[model samples]
Target: MRTMMTRRQLLQSIGSGFGMMSFAGLEAASDPLAARQPHFPARAKHVIYLFLNGGPSQVDTFDPKPALTRFHGTSAPSGNLKTERKTGALLKSPFAFRRHGQSGLEFSEIFPKLGACADDLCVIRSMYTERPNHEPSLFMFNCGHVLPGHPSMGSWLTYGLGTFNRNLPGYVVLCPGVPVIGPQLWTSAYLPAIHQGTYLPNNESEPEKLIQHLRNRNLSAEEQRRQLDLLASLNRLHLEREGGDAQLEGRIQSMEVAYRMQSEAMDALDVSREPAAVRARYGDGDFARGCLIARRLVERGVRMVQVYYGNGQPWDNHDDIQIHRRLAATSDAPMAALLQDLKASGLLKETIVLIGGEFGRTPSVEVSGLVRVQNGRDHNNHGFSILMAGGGVKGGLAYGSTDEFGFKAVEKRTHPHDVHATILHLMGMDHTKLTYRHAGRDFRLTDVAGTVVRDIIA
Candidate 1:
């Protein structure tokens, strides 16, 4: 009979994979959230951003305007300051709008699944941005400025709250091809290089390629562990000899996380491990998988997960509105499933979910209306719609609205800064207080403007 190996001897000879399954081992398993402590106890420990990429038309999805149906194919009621395009008569949504849940919130048929979760959602109908174009507006929405060079919200979260998961990055971004502005939306900017989001490609669900730079073939698990253990010891010895060096210390910690992540991160993003019914619910598509992965990462203590819906202007339907119908279908169910799954798993109470784009489309048709069938609208920056749920928001509520014809935001308007402020509030960080001294002045996610919308808070 073979003699039983001691714990240390086993670790030296075998791998940590088998050991990571045990609770005691997991407890001893390097705490992933070592750096992710919030400034205070937070209402939301995690965030999932359902970015719609190019913009979705409000009239066709969340906000319905019967008034527009009354005047379809004619110039709208609102005068001047209109979209800078060929104006057409008001066009009603092609799909029907029905009141859902006890909230009686009206959602167009385009997103049947998301509408079901209406009671848990706080839809902001009067969201407005400063840019009508895709790139600048996208940047502004994620980084707080139309130009890049600014830390993204995720970066800010990591900087302020640290991270719950040391093995994985504090923030993760899932995109297939590219967002309108690409990496700028998740860049670290003035923050430390480590605060930048870890980008996971859309098709990375494959076991072999799920995580880049994590698959190492030259060494066995025991060999790698030995190397990291030796390196960590050397780092500690050097730190003690040098007295104290923060930069060197941070590097030491980063190296340890990178070493341990080979096992932890791989398991975190493996969507294949999900049961068939579970995968089917999210839909067997890139966006769907992205949503599923978002849940897994956040559950594993990742702070923020941004799931971009499609590649290169999927929602930028300028010439054909019907084409948008397809894009809408692609995102609808997976987004809804993410919410439902989170709720059932009891994660929704502490996880904030957001859905919107850079801006919305014009109420009036611009291109696809041969003189009528698909009346595609131009990009509209003056007004749009955004949805929020969980993370300390009161559900079954609509914070603001546009005009009767859905031309512009008329009341209770919420700006991008307000959204930024609210998110920080949920994370227990006062947007005003979470500042970093850089470029000769203190910088923050809200820049110089931001007021947490008190009305939306429960």
Candidate 2:
């Protein structure tokens, strides 16, 4: 009878396909967050995800459907597509779409500021997801699954490449308040706890107030260092006794990060240090501040930074679709400025700026009775739009298309898995090869499926 080989032994013996997965095993013994070599030449070193939580209406945003406008209040074609709630006759966009940039890319008037940077954007209009609900869609988009208990894209990136900055976390999530699934959206899950995203409540502009308990009032720096050293030593001894504990190791690493942050993090989070003209350009609002902070974090070598629009589903406009105008007013300038700022700083070539929501709103008017108003659209998982800029993505382009009625992705259909795969590709990691052994099986960010939308890459 053949003897059973250890997982590591098996992986080493058959090494042709494993590629970076084998390298990852060798690096696991070192500091978990230390920077490591990518599987290949990396186009982007950092990622900034502008998560417009809640389903935003794609027809009103990047995907302009003249058919919906022409057939306004008409019901003959396409019939009713089943979604989370009941919907009525097609509801044309209230806002007008105009061509912008040298490429003549179209954008809604609600985002006039973003329209200025239209040439930098690659809008994907044929994106789809499994569920229409906020919770599952958010989970699918952020964590690559419709269920909880999976490592987020940020977590996966950190696990694959570690981080450039050791003073701060490899992955940082800036949200004024908790979104739908809260920290679970950034959870490390089967990955090491240390790879989980560091949550920062970006409600305050002041660096000190932005991160509470950042500095210890009672202990001096030297004394705190001594205490931390003692604690780390104790933890290491306990770790040796326990064989291995990810949670304990995570706590140890977090303490080291916190100690180092006493200096580096303060300077990184302080946007006021930027020139007044620069700050004014981004405009005012929590999201604007968050965007500015995201640039700052990435500039300081943070591997991934996710800037959520606001607390909860700020874009989930069920009662009235007009709420989008209000939401866009808050985000447009900052988002545009971020793209421009990255470009001006020459970071755009090496940094990715992704602006999107989990899913999108329906094209037809919602009649679900859940809301008092009839103007809003229902949840739509069939088709949506997202903007990807920089990080080697083709600029001034719209890669795919939705149906004429803007009801579904009819051409070059893209999924969240595809987006994740493409992102990992840009960062010099193969989505299929970057695997982590978990629960007696190898797991990946793309789960069991994904195809890198290579056509979208520059």
- What lDDT does candidate 1 reach at residue 37? 51
So what's the TM-score on candidate 2?
A: 0.93
lDDT of each: 0.80, 0.88
Worst 10 residues of 2 by lDDT: 1-10
Candidate number of the best lDDT: 2
Cα TM-score of candidate 1: 0.86
Q: List residue ranges in candidate 2 displaced over 4 A.
A: 1-29
Cα lDDT of model 2 by residue, 1-458, tens digit = 11123333444465555443322243354567788788899999999999999889999989899988789998938597789998888899999999999989999999998998989999999999999898889999999989999999999898888899878889999999999889999999978788899999898889988888999999999888779877766665565455566678778778878887887899999999999999998989899999999999999899999999999999999879999999999999999999999999999999988999999989999988799999999989999999999999999999899889888999999999999999999999999888888777888889999999999899
lDDT for residue 153 in candidate 1, whole number 0-100: 92
Worst 10 residues of 1 by lDDT: 1-10
The most accurate candidate by TM-score is 2
Clashes of each: 10, 0
Model 2: residue 322 alpha-carbon error in angstroms:
0.8
Q: Candidate 1, overall lDDT?
A: 0.80
Model 1 clash pairs? 32-165, 32-166, 33-164, 33-165, 35-163, 36-162, 36-163, 73-89, 74-89, 369-372
* Model 1 lDDT per residue over 1-458, tens place: 11122233334454545433432243254332345455577788788999998898988888888987787777765552455456565666777899999999989888889999999999999998887788788888899988879989998887777677667888899988788778888987766656778788876667447666776789997777777666655654565455555455456556656676887888888888999998888897889999999999988989899999877878877666787778878888898899999999999999999999999988787743333545587788888899999888889998899988776899998899999999999888889888877778888889899899988887
